[model samples]
Target: MLAPTGWSGRFWARTECSFDGAGKGSCTTGDCGTGGMECKGNGAAPPATLAEFTLAGPASAKDYYDVSLVDGYNLPMMVDARGGAGGCASTGCVADLSRRCPSELRVGDACRSACEAFGKPEFCCSGAYANPTTCRPSVYSQMFKSACPQSYSYAFDDSTSTFTCSGADYTITFCPESAPR
Candidate 1:
């Protein structure tokens, strides 16, 4: 996708898909509910890995991007930013969380986020914990962070998780083999 300057959106991959010749089918995971191969502006289902981006907006020259596991992880993904300023680099998770996911949070081969697994205020960062000052990462979120330091493990992980670049093109790879060691 050719994202224009100032564009902000997310990218993700669908797994276990089975579409016919007419581009009609369903995916066991990350099914965007569009009833076809194209999502048509629809969002993916839960248990999907995400790569979020915000191109150089009007107010700032820096573009921002990150891989997110806040909705839990369904696949390995990475984001590589090149030809930009501020030392743009690659970030994401190569490790498969499915095998290590806690039993309660496991849904088939995907791992569910803590908020999805337990819908509690603390886990969801809602109610009293809605603000960044009050909200904090849970043990489960920590597990994800431990495995993927450059990615967002929870809602308020912006300080360490978000990356910045100026005038850079991005390559988001699913099931990437070159994830950082």
Candidate 2:
């Protein structure tokens, strides 16, 4: 069994069929075949002329969010969310989205909104999610130093962890990859 990281499935390898008589049905992501198996140049390379499996390396960080990726895997999800890959950690933690949002937003105004969805950022470093600054109240920093000491990034694009201030709506893509289908 394979574990989840972030890669989509392997591209379907094409197979070489001979027009040596009987017609068989075949097609790729794009063009559909004619009376016989027509390799209609579907953009991707055709199938292998031989039978073999090419094991690729681990899935990249983005693939996990695509519909085609993580197709076969039974993911761990929030109990109530059901087969839908529940919770932000499971289904909502993607990086790319079909839509783009402003890199920054004011705390009170609505920033990025997709349909009915809205992104209101939160300082993950608050309270239990924050750290103690003991002898230091670095006025230079609004964020309590040593707070959220570990989780501060979404690795793929290497962007900073977004935050929304009190009484503000921050502009951020609502999810990791995209909106829930």
Candidate 3:
């Protein structure tokens, strides 16, 4: 789908889905909880790989984007900027994190973030740990970062995870292949 020049949105893949002729059904992963094929402005359920984008707008000259596993991870995903200037590098988590997901965070085919699994302030980066200085990466987020250095392993990983570009289009690829690290 095409978005306007200044459009901002997120995208993700849905797995193990079944929809009837009326476009009503659910997906095992990234369902969006709308109970239908269309998300209807609903965000994906947790344990999903997300590709978020904020296109250039009046207040900003550059576009910002990232492949985030902060909510968790269900699959490998990548985002590439095409024909952009300044920091148009590719970024993603092509690694299959589910294979190495911690036992407590494992959910069938997906992996839950530490925050989702425990709901602690340290893991969720909330309450007392709501800032970049206070919300440091935990062991689980560290492991995620080790596996996917370009992905948003935690909420405060903006420095290394977020990318920027100007005057370009993006291509989000699910299950992108890259040489093993």
Q: Model 1: clashing residue pairs? A: none
**Backbone clashes per model, in order?**
0, 9, 0
Off by over 4 Å in 3: 179-181
For residues 1-181, what per-residue lDDT tens digits would candidate 1 score against the true structure?
7888899888988888999999999998888998899999998888889999888878989999999999889999989988888989899989888878999999999998989888999998999999999999999999999988888999999998999999788998898765422
Model 1: lDDT equals 0.89
lDDT of 3 by residue, 12-49 (tens): 99898999999889998898998998898999988899
The parts of candidate 2 lying over 4 Å away from their true place are: 1-23, 31-63, 67-181
Q: Sorted on lDDT, highest at the top, how do the candidates line up?
A: 3, 1, 2
For each candidate in the order shown, give its overall lDDT on alpha carbons: 0.89, 0.22, 0.91
Residue 98 miss distance in model 1 (angstroms): 1.0
What TM-score does prediction 3 earn? Answer: 0.95
* Candidate 2 lDDT trough over 10 residues, lowest sum: 70-79
lDDT of 3: 0.91
Q: TM-score for each prediction? A: 0.94, 0.16, 0.95
Higher-TM-score candidate among 1 and 2? 1
